[model samples]
Target: MESSKHKHYHVHDFDSRQFLENYFSDKSDMVFGDDTLKFVIDNLKQIFSEGHINGDILIDLSIGSFIHHLYSACEFFKNIIVLKVNNRCIMELKRWVDERTGAFYWGHTSTLLQEKEVNSDHFEDKEGHLRSAIQHVVKYDLDKENMTDPLVLPPADCVISDCLLDAISKDQDDYIRYLRKFSRLLKPGGHLIIIGCLDTTYFTVGKDKFHVFTFDEDFVRKALVGEGFIIDYCNVKKRTAVSDLIDYKAIMIIAAHKEK
Candidate 1:
């Protein structure tokens, strides 16, 4: 027999140790605002309304601030799954879901940040199927060294890489490798959502330097088209604010994938 009462579980994970803190830190006051939420919700609504995610699987690769989006998507879809490759982010996600009810599943995430190992765990979960029936895989890559092989990567209905592509890759070749990998991760007509800041320099996590690519919107748009993802929509949100008594401005890009 099992208890059927909802318990208020206050679990916090390490997955969000980097991004969440940054988003809520003094520096974030200069970067993000209410418009960011509106920007994300609008894309979500567009995707969900298309009936693309009704019964489909969604794999949230990095599980940054977007975990909230998945929590909300659970209200519209019967099944939603998130993959947290980092132990820090996984803990944060569980904390976010502690007392919430939704149609979502979580995959295995270890403290080890190895793609091969994580992919192996995903494969074992798949058990030999060429494609897992999971809704989608939102792959977020902040560490470029881990963008190894997409052919071996798990299948996802849609892919959301938010400001991660440039953050991970050091050069265009590396970036192209990831874009190609993303193309292969989805079906011919699968959707890809990319949101990123343009002309950004670098971000730090706990004294470690993390790089950001100059996300040229025109260049990315052309690249996505070449990669075979149709441009369903494109929106750029600009923000200027004061954080830590300093002023900063940022430009963000949102693009939708086209059906094949």
Candidate 2:
């Protein structure tokens, strides 16, 4: 597919609410629930449960307003700093954080996390905990050397990016460049956890077809290594559920740490 045919996320007006409803909602017919939501949640739970990724701060640079991935993260980090490339995503996230009306309901995701917990807490408590842990929701500029300039953030103990690279990057060089930026936000030895779709060209949300940078597992592994990261864990799940909304061969979760 020609890149020009697909819209860029930075130039496009993404319907954040519609995206949540389409994929993250509790609706029985959601397409990406099992392949994406469940896959990420389960891997995150196991990663955090292993006690290798806990720290004082975890920086989130994920796509969309989804918070399911952070349910397990709140238990491990005292603070979570969210960096968004667009205001739409920031507003959607703030609506949920501020407990405003019309915020996308994530109870279904919280429930999924609860089932994995040995001593499950109530949904309200889980939501409250995540909200309290989110320290800031700041805007970022990919073009800037300091993505979050004028608000110099302390080096985080861990950084989590979910599909943000693939969504924003135009090519392999852009992906590696963004990865370098994410690496700079972390302290040496700090872990970087990524959840990304593999071999995908585009994804649609409310009639907008957003370009997705296509890459394979070997490319990702090389990118991380070249950026001075030591891969600790990597998992890939082949696309199972059929859907016209997106074309992805697989989903990958990788846990790596900056070399000390």
Candidate 3:
């Protein structure tokens, strides 16, 4: 991982509305909604299209308060588990998982995936499948050695980490350590899908700012390869919108497997 000393923002609070507006509102207005989100989904969809993804458990450990990324992988796994270090984030996701009244509109994501499949009428079925696939949404604490802490988890078939490391980690070294933690949660030969903020150092959420550990594609590849992973797919897309909320120059997605 690459290292650089910079101003790190304090993660005081998390708001669902603010989070969505900053990242997922629209391409023209937001930092992530337009081309950025699609590239992420497209890379995942590419992996899903190649088959061999059937697994009993898929862990969404990315700390994403929304299910946009899961829209692509949920169909490939029998069970989905979401882990987050923030209580507010967990609550936000729970509200959506329970079919609460004011959940974000994720219809477009399902529509995108539906267009890829031959049977286009099963969009509802996909939603139902995802609701069923997500069996657990638990609290996580990155500061602890055992991220799960008191609770022990069964070996995961795949672990998805997206824009999470930079959110909580203090530095690039810490980021690498947390990655080892993620690898420990997976079984040998299991998949590790990571999405990163390429060459970005910070992001704003609500009133407080959060630090993003800046790194490039080379560091990412070397980090995963050093961890005994064979990168199957990797891509990076530069950010389109310019805003203080987003400080990253690009977004990256990687799909790799642990060596058995």
Clashes of each: 18, 0, 0
Which parts of model 3 are misplaced by more than 4 Å?
A: 1-11, 26-28
lDDT of each: 0.48, 0.90, 0.77
lDDT of 1 by residue, 70-189 (tens): 433443444455554455555455543552453122221111111323254653422112122323333334344444324235455666666556555566777777777656656556
Model 3 weakest lDDT span, ten residues long: 1-10
lDDT of 2 by residue, 1-260 (tens): 56678888766888888888877888878878887889999999898889999889999998888899999899899999999888999999999999999888988888788787777645459999999999999998888888888889999999999999999988899999999989999998999999999999998899888899999999999999999999999999999877788899999999999999
lDDT comparison, 2 vs 3, better candidate? 2
Ranking of candidates on lDDT, top first: 2, 3, 1
Cα RMSD for candidate 2?
Answer: 1.2
Q: Of the candidates shown, which would achieve the greatest TM-score relative to the real structure?
A: 2
lDDT of 3 at 223: 89
Query: Residue 54 error for model 2, in Å?
Result: 1.5
lDDT of 3 at 173: 82
| Runs with alpha carbons beyond 4 Å of true place in candidate 1 | 1-15, 24-31, 50-54, 63-66, 75-77, 99-154, 206-208, 244-253
TM-scores for every candidate against the unseen true structure: 0.63, 0.97, 0.91
Task: Give the TM-score (vs. native) of candidate 3.
Answer: 0.91
Residue 8 displacement (Å), model 1: 35
Return the clash pairs for model 3, or none: none
* Candidate 3 residue lDDT tens string, 92-129: 77877888998776676676677777778766677667
